[model samples]
Target: MNYETFAPHPNLDAIVKCHWILEVPGDMEAPKQRVIPDGCIEMCFILGDDVKRFNSENEFIIQPRAMVFGQITKPYFVKPTGYVNTFAVRFYPYGFANFITQPIHELADKETPLTSLFEESSIKELEQKIIEAASTKSRIAIIESFLLSRLTDKSIIDNIVTSTIDSLSQTKGSASINSILKDDLSKRRNLERKFSKQVGISPKQLGRIIRLQAALKMMLNKPGENLTQVAYENEYYDQAHFTKDFKEFTGVNPKQYLDNDQMMLSSLIYSKD
Candidate 1:
């Protein structure tokens, strides 16, 4: 398994997290290469063999070679068909919301083709151009161009949504729903309705997942650090609380996560962030 991440253009620094390229050669089982739950949406283009995302029953189903995965609410698995080569654009926590208008949560637990979501013939051409680009510069240019087209109306971002996003960024995903919702208690139910339509998962759920990424990074950065201390520093109620959140997101305990020799796709992405 080989992974690489490219820095975003200066103009897009606030929205795009980064553009990354991941290539897994044939016979690379990628068994422990788990995609931990993170509150970010990603667009992937497969240049090689088929890949499958398992269902709750562990059933494998073919996913489109080109698709977008919205903020994952839970841990999920991906195994390459053979010699998988994927070029993906990983958006910031709120990045994907800028592109699609329908329910973001529908992207969960399945692969939705770029054709169905972006729908624009131009959008399809942009993805193809990116995948075919010989140099990273060309790929970046393609996405940057697309973003420039979409940002024509920066004012389209609504007040309620942007404020909640500001709250999340301010807390680094550590803030709770009750605290963030204090601004507009009456909008609580309406907020989620908009979130489901625009942001994918509810804001609270996205915050929790984002917080897990933070905690995981703290642990991975200092592999030999004390787990309980790490938990406290991350604001978990206790070691038990930390452990539960960790398992819920990565489907593995911190201790086991530390000792495991296999590379974690999610952790790799988080560390870069």
Candidate 2:
């Protein structure tokens, strides 16, 4: 497996999180990767064997070649159907709203094709262009060009959302929803409505995911860190409560998560972005 990450262009700081490329061979077997709840959305271009998202024991959905995965509200599972090769864009929670017109929330549980959100012919060309633009400038310019040309609604770029995001990042996703909204209840409510409509999940839920994300990275990076401390550090209720949330997000106990055969995809924000 080979993984690479790149920083976003300064101009796209609002909508773009970062760019990444991942490659894993087909012969190698990996554990089913758990898809946790994250505050953000993703757009990916598959360069190899397809991936499968299981809806049930027997039901699954295949990802399209060029797809934008909307904000996920609940946990899900993904396993590569064959060798996995992909390049993707990780967007902030509110980012996709600027580029996509169709309510992203409606795509909560599925991998909808780009054509559904954009013009069919344009999507084909855009996909090719993004893949072809490997350099940082080229990639950033492509994303910016898409928004500037296709998404002319200047009002979608919001200052309040950016301010809230700044504070949210500083706290490592542990900020209180009430505190975050205390000063502007109306603005918070409006954000909630817009978030649900555009991002597919509530702000509070995204915050929890963010906190879990922080804890997951800490636990992974600092192997010696104890669970009780991890829980307390992330502001969970208690050790048991913390374990429960971790298991819910990961589908495995914290102690067992790393050892699992599945390569679960928790929020990789801390590591990549």
Candidate 2: TM-score?
0.88
lDDT score, candidate 1: 0.75
Give the least accurate 10-residue stretch of model 1, judged by summed lDDT: 151-160
**Model 1 ranges off by over 4 Å:** 27-29, 56-58, 261-263
Q: Global lDDT of each model?
A: 0.75, 0.75
lDDT of 1 by residue, 186-271 (tens): 88888887777666788887777767777888877777889899888777889999899888877789888776644466666667
Candidate 2 Cα deviation (angstroms), residue 168: 2.4
lDDT by residue for model 2 over 58-165, one digit each (tens)?
688887989988877666888888888787888887778878676767877678798888899988888889778766467657766775576566577566666666
Kindly state the number of residue pairs that clash in model 2: 1
Global fold similarity of model 1 (TM-score): 0.87
Q: For every candidate structure, what is the RMSD over all alpha carbons to the true structure, in angstroms? A: 2.5, 2.6
